[model samples]
Target: MDDTDTHLLRLLQHNADTSHAELGRQVGLSATGVHKRLRRLREDGVIKRTAIVLDRAKLGLDLMCFLKVNFKNNLASPNLDELHGAVSALPEVLECYTLTGTNDAIVKVAVRDHVALREFLQRFSEAQSIIERVETCIVLEEIREGNDYAVPKPQ
Candidate 1:
């Protein structure tokens, strides 16, 4: 992708609701041109999907925590698929990523309160026997949370 495509992505990242005309105006492209570019980006999978960002606090999700999961290496064949499936089945788990360090995976979770968190953890631990240890850290304050990535500034 060129500079123009990158600029369009940056604009959309800020506000997916921005009209094609408005995007065209800012990027110096015609409305149709903007549409074609966006379509191409989507087809190529650069623009995966668009959805609204919600306020966790407003939704009564007052607790945000991270879980560091370590697996038992002694297992001849770890049931990684089962662990992943369990994680995916839980709505409270916002995100999960495979790690390269001591932990096997890191999970981001959000819940209403401590009781809910404890329940979620209990279920999670029980769901997978391969889990050796799960360490949790409650977020005191979220400075920033977003999917935005750095794009080159428009000239």
Candidate 2:
């Protein structure tokens, strides 16, 4: 990834719908050149699938909560994969991360209301063999939320 490649990535990160010709104009490359670079980036796995960002509230997912989960055993335990599979299968789970220190994992979930939240918790409780305890925090408001990332210059 060179400077031009990084610049293209940054532009695409901001708006995936930007035309190749426009990107080329900004990055000083031809449309075909821009297309080739983007193709290479996708093939190299540097660029993941492009997706549209949806409004959660408008989609009826009004409640957003973060769940801090503590596992019953070590992270290296055999049941780790089982827990991961289960979590990944949940559509409500927007993000799940393994963590160090006190919490074993943190899960970001979106639901319709308190009833849906409770239902999610009930389903989560089925994995109690690996999960020791869970702490929940409801997001009252979202000041800013985005998945955009800054593309760093190549070393």
Candidate 3:
């Protein structure tokens, strides 16, 4: 991507609702040119689907917790696809990733309150027999949460 493309991505990252005309005005391109570029970016997979970020707290999801999970079986021996599929099906689990360390995987969960979180954990534990232990850390405050990434200038 060139400088103009990088600029366009940065602008879209800040506000996906930005108009093509406005983007053209800022990037010194015509509306048609901006649209073409954006289309190309999307086709190239540089630009993924645009989505609205929500305030979890306002939506009654007051609890955010990170769970470190260790499996009873060895990592190489277990069927990871089954584990991932089970975790992904849980509504409360926002993110789950396999990690390299003491824990086999890490999960980020959002729930209504402590009671809800407890119930969610109980359900999660029951979902998979491979889960040996789960360590949770409740997020007291979220100072910053964003999906934006830095777009480097073309070399």
Please list all clashing residue pairs in model 2, or write none if there are none: none
User: What are the per-model C-alpha RMSD values against the true structure?
Assistant: 2.3, 1.2, 1.4
Deviating ranges (above 4 Å) for candidate 3: none
The ten-residue window of minimal lDDT in model 1 covers 73-82
For candidate 3, write residues 1-155 as lDDT tens digits: 89999999999999999999999999999999999999999999998898998989799999999999888874755547657767878999988888898999889999999999999998888887888899999998898888899899999
- Model 1: lDDT to the true structure: 0.90
User: Highest TM-score: which candidate?
Assistant: 2
lDDT of model 3 at position 55: 84
Per-model TM-score, in order, reads: 0.93, 0.94, 0.93
Q: Arrange candidates by lDDT, highest first: which order?
A: 1, 3, 2
| Candidate 1 C-alpha error for residue 38, in Å | 0.2
Worst 10 residues of 2 by lDDT: 74-83
Candidate 1's residue-wise lDDT over 59-143, tens digit each? 9999999999888862234557867788989999999987787888889999999999999999999898888899999999989
With candidate 1 superimposed using the best TM-score fit, by how many Å does residue 117's alpha carbon deviate from the native? 0.3
Instruction: For model 1, name the residue pairs that clash.
Output: none
Lowest summed lDDT over 10 consecutive residues: which window, candidate 3?
74-83
